[model samples]
Target: MEKPRKTAIFSQVPTLEEPRIDANILIRLLQVAIDRDFEAAEVALLKTLIQDPCLNFQAVADKTGYQMYYLRGQVGPRLWADFTEVFGRSYGAEIGKRNFGDFIHCFLEKLSLMPNSFLQQDLEQHQIAQIFEPGEGEWAIAPSESWFYGRSKELDSLGKLLSQYRLVTLIGDVGVGKTALAARWTERFGAKSFDRVIWKSIAHAPEPDILLNELLQEFEVKELPQKLSEKMSVLMQIIKRQRCLIVLDSAESLIRTTAITALDPYTSPDYGRMIRFFAEEPHQSSLLFISRRRFNDVLRLSRANRAAATMRLEGLQPKEAQRIFEAHGLKNSSDWQRLIQIYAGNPQYLISISEYIQTVFSGSVQEFLRCDTVIVPDIVCQEYITQIQEINAEHRALLFHLAALKDPVHFDQLVVNLATSMKSQSALIKALNDLTEMNLVEKQQNNAILFGLNPIVKKVILSFPFIGGS
Candidate 1:
């Protein structure tokens, strides 16, 4: 007999009480996966995914026994709507509200991540807290007093540039401490030269009105201006009266949509006008921008000159990372160097993995180094996979191969080997370039580039059942 026709009215509605995995359950399931308790996380993921109790989102949580947080990264309006309809709020709400969007208009203003956030509920909590609550510690500064190690020259260079221009742009990869260095200097010493220090983070692009309101509220302004122009004029007047230092944290603030409508007042020009008029053009005032990329590449800040002083925050020098270890009372230079190489100078990685090493090895860096395993945790690798996916597929393939190999293999031999499976030599080189740009691979002094997949990245790749067996 034919199956009975399905009727909408006959369908059983799912509820939070139904033991069906809702967004809340799905997200928590994802967290357990990246927490890398594979034995535990897998059991939970399988139960949540294998028999989904019928949800719209497919079993993307499977494909690999990794976090569902890596959503093949559609990150478009459709996904946002789909998740919101099912989950009752944007993914940001599950993570934290204040950092992400609230409703219409001011949507997706920021696209940054908490370093290795998928695995850490604490970081997620901190960002989500910002959604509804206005926060004071919005700006990050490397405390000069406690700024134990790394990048002294970069700091001095930043100081010199600020001495010349009223505004300076600090750009680098995530976890490079751009905000820390900026705030540390200003809070420690810049206050004497620059009368006042004000820090603001544009994590989610706020409306000019909202931002202005916050500034007024923070400064305890008695009167407010109605129009933006009038407001900037008044704000500029106030800023001018006091020698001020302003840190516009997060590079996202510099952007306006490429498709903004004519009626929209939040044009690139309006934003630029406000910054230049209120902050940059004000008398004896200095402004600093901390961002992931050179803000100009992504967003056109109103009048921020192409010639404005720029600093590309580089990785922690080997010696600097060593000091970080030594400060923690870890001896053994060779073992420490190996650990730094595993983290590759990103402060978050260095700090985290080093802490782990200390906890396990108790300053005996050699004990931590004894295991040939790359020191990175499974979660960090999983966290970076979306970024890894953005790399050229051919290069990603090479990366997977290197990951499987585990021990560093000779460059030419490996290239020749991977090339046989790829389309051509050109394809191999292009793939290498992609991996290089993503910092998954590095070239040795002899020009032999190797896939230095941060230990965690290597481990995750190797754990994939079919990595190089294909």
Candidate 2:
């Protein structure tokens, strides 16, 4: 015996008494949400998808007489893909009938009221209110402050990115304020925009499994996924459920020193995969990467996607640097300008000098400038020295030559200057590229790729006794 054929005449319809609204209204809203062409059959299919008490696609296919192939392959994917595009993430598995009710509920509540809307109830304000308050997952976020300055532009830019993009990398030299900027921005814009803000600092570049397990714990996942891919999927599911802001500070700790200049993925395999997953997957959440160096994979992705971006923090402006001086009660505002120029307005350097003046010179800005020809915080100088020692002698020589130059030099000029003393043009180019990535050398604004050393970096190099004093 064969099974009997089912037709639209036999399809079941429900009244308002059974549920909240007519199935037709839901089908119309969904069509508007997805911006799709729905014929009578597709409408019937959607009615089954939403109104069926079982919430089972396969069972509905059997009862409605529509081929499972069309329902599963053609209509289902289109609907979900549109949802992901509109909502910026997926709420359920790609193939499953699970989460249908939650999806309906969220859409009904979250979406703007459409014309001819027949919603029985609007979205609850409590759901929107919950995102602004700190939740269980906020233990990892850093505290915000009131004294942060000169980063309003950066904060606004990050605000736009978090709304539109999934991954953002904040790159700068150490003490250039990457961490502070990220933390401050989170407090200003992120605190209200996201439901959970989790901050983690990579102290020693732990293995992927360890980090993954830790993150799962933070999410309070009781039954952890066995595989890395499964873990990523589960994490993304949580992101879809609630707005999340994940801040990973000191991201450069995970990249091998030698690999920093290489045009390859980050040296840490697990972290590399994480970056790729964040960039490629659809999620409403944003990941903030604060690092001294840029991840090549992230740079590549950001270049290709406006939704992913990199914000390279530079030195503070003169007016902004003045606040640091005033906070220390330092006098001689004009002399402070000279110090700012020498340090290129780096807050760490200014603070260190201010403390030194307060203790030894009675906050005399002139006396501080008179004694220090190469002014920098001792810690910053040590860091610069360490970074310089990482490269070979040829790269070191190129950096010395760059520091010695009065203005930015073109590649050909650089080659000519180093013809007898330095390595070949290719080696010099490679070294220059490496130095630029490390934030020691910067390209000048010209059609030709002219390169120059950072002012503070040059001062530090000149101050090296063995390198011949300025």
Candidate 3:
């Protein structure tokens, strides 16, 4: 008996001998808001097609030294389907007819018309102004909108976390409204929930000493603690005595991605000691951390382990997205529903796109949908793209593999697929766990416990250039 061969799904395509468009240009085009690491197999195939658009699957298969059966049956269909979904066209048919270069030209031309491109062009010609001033007071941090739609149910759960847990973390992807929700929660119940409320933003990555001193100043401690240990003791005493509620925005700064060991405290030893003491020791006060990524130290102490608590935010419900659309004074159409789905109900993304449509397409959701392009504004795109690109290469590659699966996969399947790329089992598990922590991958609720990439994440991964020449 012989074992079955398993070639990579994207490796069937050959590298381009002479590309029509600059490979770098194509690469830049694919790097959207949800950018991920390039896939080698796909990149090779794409490069080949860019050089010789008329080459069919058989030619690609021959060039790559892969069986035509494997290339055509497994790789070609998935590739075509992904292109169709992203480009909103019969991309596969165009490729077959050797009109791929023409399609690329037209797509790039339309991309230039998008609002994001306008910003990009300006950025290329000018320097951006820095506007991230240190935030002060709960009022300064709170959502400016007088009315917040949706999140009623989330508020209830949040209330529970605040009441029961010593430490609570609000985690979500960029622009998922974590800060708005945190600020609103604090503003609504600040006085009643605790004796004192304090808000601070770590957006500028302040040092642990600076953060501690600022809080101490707020506490009006006449005698400052000279040592880190003494500072933690003093902080704990204040928290217990005053029943304070501390809100730390962008808490991901405390995370040390360069840590030598997983068990080690977060990058800032002082901050790590502070959170540990807050979670472990008895105290009347609570701390709320809002961040795009969850820190290992925080999770270790979360209520799941009978220590702290965490709330992971998802996109808004359809009705909530509708509120955004209505706010923008846009009329509803069938395309409205699809638009919401395409952006995964991200509030910031919805607002940005709605404004883009209003300003550029005369508030016509139908016209925008007919164009069939993912049009995330430069501001929101930069936010998400930075977060995605920050992940280490190995973990990122794991995510790319998950995205390529296109279906729910079991742990064993992932292990086998990952091993084919020569990743160690332990490393593979670590990468998978990292993805889980970021909420990029979800485990099915069923007992079987299959895993799959979130739909929006998958779309972003597919949008990246599949070619490597760039």
Candidate 4:
């Protein structure tokens, strides 16, 4: 009798019509099978395979910008072993570059035949494992804490607010440590309190659609919708099921300071809608918005809903401000309190002032104070100038008038001071409210309500050439 011919590894499995699987679906399958995430190169290879299954290793390397040797040697062998452990040896036997798509299609078809509960359970378990893994889920795109000092009360307050509310807005002046506080809180309690911690800064002013798409991808959504409405719905579903803490820093970039409207036209309406949904919808997640000025919608929603809250961050306490001076190696501890008071305990201003003292006054706080003039750093001045430019001419005039004040003045006094520049009392009141919202003017409630600029802010305004003498 003739010897029976051995069947080839690729020929043993019956060929089925290759179904077109979404790249994201294939990526999810691969992630599940391997019990881990893919590096950029591996993900690129898989995405490329969806377009052309018959491409060789060289072709994949050319498209993906990965070396052919790296793909064929290190990547190929590891994938083969990983697939073999998940699928049987027959399915994993001949998974080369040319037949990679065939393998994926066959595996997916087999997966479709498996019980739905089994697949769901596996996926759930995988996600749970990822969540519980130590130091796993923090995506800290915000700046790190260089030298964080006391905010014990604020930190505790944040914890309590996050527990009770789904949306919390941390509003403050430009350099009042809002970003630092958010970052530090995330560093301390993020892993323990939530499944994932995501930090994003919109300082560059990304479009709402682009931002939503990026966030959906971050959550590993299998299919993203083309419409913003659908995307918000899907995101709400994910947050409802999974405990998440998301921080949007530099939120003022999207808000309008000149008007009571929550956002400027540069930002899409969808962004505001998304914020409303997060605030209104019941979910087990928290969205923290850090902005210099509070949004009108946030204010409105916060009043109506217990799930939304806003915290107006102020300058650090005298004790906390002392630490910054100490870290800068400044002398004259006796005068530290005076220095802190002058700077209003603003962390960034203190840090900049401390460094200036260290550089110019030989680390002597007394010497720096003796100069008897508010020393606004260039960076801080530029920030103030930028903010001033965004406001209307009436608001700018009001700020300049405030800068000229010898002491906090009453509302009536402001009207008289700005009578020529602003003829309408309602417009003057509106301007004061806008400036207060921007944290540029401080409100003092003594026998009467009085408004004045922080010494540092007044100094910056007076020194600013364009508006100095106006």
In terms of lDDT, which candidate is strongest? 4
What's the true lDDT of residue 25 in model 2?
58
Residue-pair clashes per candidate: 9, 0, 9, 0
Question: Which digits, one per residue and each the tens of the lDDT, describe model 4 over residues 240-267?
Answer: 9999998888888887655545235325
lDDT of 1: 0.51
| Candidate 3 residue pairs in clash (backbone atoms < 3 Å) | 10-41, 16-47, 16-48, 18-51, 42-466, 43-466, 43-467, 302-308, 303-308
Residue 31, candidate 4: Cα error in Å is 33
Summarize candidate 3's per-residue lDDT along 40-70 as a digit string, tens digits.
5555566666555544455565677765557
- What lDDT does the true structure give each of the candidates? 0.51, 0.67, 0.63, 0.73
Name the regions of candidate 3 deviating beyond 4 angstroms: 1-147, 258-261, 303-307, 401-417, 420-422, 442-470
Candidate 2 ranges beyond 4 A from true positions: 1-138, 143-147, 259-263, 403-408, 417-423, 445-450, 459-470
Worst 10 residues of 2 by lDDT: 2-11
What TM-score does each of the candidates earn?
A: 0.50, 0.64, 0.63, 0.69
Error of 1 at 62 (Å): 44
What is the TM-score (0 to 1) of candidate 1?
Answer: 0.50
Give the Å error, residue 185, model 1: 0.5
- Candidate 1 local lDDT, 255-339, one digit each (tens): 4322222233233556656655543453666667786534342233334453355677877898787766664556577667667
Model 1 lDDT, residue 323, Cα:
61
Poorest 10 consecutive residues by lDDT, candidate 1:
96-105
Please give the distance, in angstroms, between residue 367's alpha carbon in candidate 2 and its true position after superposition.
2.6
